[model samples]
Target: MTVLGIETTTDVCGVALNRNGVQLDSIVKNEKHIHAAQLVPMIENLLSRNQLKVFELDGIAVSIGPGSFTGLRIGLSVAKGLAYSSHLPLAAVSTLQSLAYPVWKTIPATESIILSVTEIQRDEFAYALFRAIDFIENHVPDFHLITKNEKETVEKIFENPLHHFLLCGFQAEKFYSMFCSENRNVSFAGKEFNACSATSIASLGERYLERNVIADVSSLEPVYGKNFIAKKSNLFSRITQ
Candidate 1:
């Protein structure tokens, strides 16, 4: 299974090529606030380094975001174009879940619950709490791997206390604070794995693909989260009240 993965949810834009659930080559450029101009070329170079072409990929994975709105769009555009042109299956991975990789890796398989956080600026950040399931090897749709965003994200974390919970992402530092008081079972990632990367997305994407969980790219879209509905802070307005 040859899979190509892309991640551009924050200041980082990354591309990774994977063969049978293993990483072959990856390129990530830290443009911070400059994802638009840097993403394509980085991908081209990455593909070249790996000696591959767009059409050669069996499947393409994209980080469908809960990060920067424009950043997410740029990645989706690129992903859609590649999938359209090459006739490859589009696997839209969750940005919040990609951030959870470090949390998953640092801890063992025993840790079932994870509260992944990414800073979204203006006082709100992207968050997702995943309660890991039994490793059942099945192949379905990628989107199905993630339960849709329910209102009880925070509550879910508090309800089932696992061995430990991993929290890390672009805004992990800032976001971790929001749930610190509420969930006593939480554990955080240190500086090394703090940021988002395509490698992690690819790894998780590979896992999803193996499980037969996949989603059609045509119906795939970026998620900006419920926080972006209004311009100002939904969190701040509530806090001041």
Candidate 2:
């Protein structure tokens, strides 16, 4: 299956052409806050370089957020347009899961837990913990995406970190330090630990596609920023026009 994956949910803007889990050509830019302007051109460039068109793709995989609001919108806008025009299946992959793969690739696979976190600002965060124990057993990273968020709660849940944990993402450093400040039994992830990858996103989408887990194109809403409704009071305050 040839899948075209587009990800702009965070600081990174990437487009990858993955043929059945193996990435062929991918373009990634990590210039912070450039997602809105860079996402489409990056995808167009990647597709043009590969000489592939929309009709040649089997599915459209997108990182359905928990990232930036504007970034998510820009990516979804293009994705929805392409899927609608090409009549292809649209697949959604979690932002956090996409972060887990590189970190998972670095570890021993089993007997270790991965705690992935992204900064949410306002002194809070978004995080998920996955027991990569299955990766070591030959089942190919069959771990569930577990939530460990809202600050104080995750701190309590992982008080004893004997299971060899690795943390990665935008605010991974912050969380790592938080655990240490509490004197929790957690290990640290160096600069060499992990970063989001388009190939990983494509691979993850391929897994869901093979399982017949798909969604209706029109029904494919941008993830993450779904709850960012305009505050009613704020709206009322600016109605002087």
Candidate 3:
């Protein structure tokens, strides 16, 4: 099956084509604030280069995130539009799951844990934990928001000494240091696995397609992980007073 994947859950904006769970090609840009302007064009370019039309693809996959609010919205908007126009099925893949997928593939150990961490805002992070055995299983199925010093919750998850632990995703290095110690069996994933990738999204997208897991395009929304509270501007407050 051929699937088109869109990823805009972080600073990275990417589009990829996957056939039978293998990435055929991908185009990615790692510049902040460019997703709105560049996402659709990147998709067009990727499809054109592959000599494929939107209708010809089996399905569309998009990162439904607990990452950048704006980026997630842009990506889902485009994916939903395409799904609506082309009458294609949509798969909403977790942003954190996609981040950990590559690392999961590389680990040879029978039992391991992957902690996927990404910055949601300044000094705040969103994380998801997965247990990798024969396949990656979501231990903490939902993304949880946490502050820098909030290591107790995460600590409890990986407290078991039998399993190897891996820290990955956008702000993985910071968390690795926070979690790593002489007594813990822990390691940091390579820098390449730290960023979200369209290839991983597409690969997981294909699996979802095979399992008949399609999203309801009309009601789908990004998982922001935290409530958005717009602080009142000082000018507005003064005027009101």
Please report, in order, the local distance difference test score of every candidate based on alpha carbons: 0.67, 0.67, 0.80
Candidate 3 is scored at a TM of 0.89
Q: Pairing residues by index, what is the TM-score of model 1?
A: 0.78
Candidate 1: which stretches are off by over 4 Å?
Answer: 134-163, 181-184, 226-241
After superposition, which runs of candidate 2 have C-alpha atoms over 4 Å from their true positions? 134-151, 160-162, 181-184, 230-241
lDDT string for model 3 (1-241, tens) is: 9999999999999999999867899999999999877887788888889999888999999998888878887788888878877889998899889999898888775667787888888777888778777443341266788886777766777677887778889878776766555436677877887889998889888888887888998888888776653222111121112
Better of 1 and 3 by lDDT: 3
Q: How accurate is candidate 1 locally (lDDT)?
A: 0.67
Tens digits of per-residue lDDT, candidate 2, 1-241, equal: 9888878777778888889667898999988788756676677677778887777788888877677777677677677667667777777777777777677777774768776666545434566667786531221223222233444655666666565567776667776665434544456666654466677777777777887777676666655623764111111111111
After superposition, candidate 3 runs with Cα above 4 Å error: 134-140, 181-183, 228-241
Instruction: Write the residue-wise lDDT of candidate 1 on 153-227 in tens digits.
Output: 554546655446666666566556554545667666666667878987777777777766677765666776644
Candidate order by decreasing lDDT: 3, 1, 2
Candidate 1 C-alpha error for residue 31, in Å: 1.5
Q: Which numbered prediction scores highest in lDDT against the true structure? A: 3
Span of ten consecutive residues with least summed lDDT in model 3: 232-241
Model 1 Cα shift for residue 87 (angstroms)? 0.7
> By TM-score, how accurate is candidate 2?
0.80
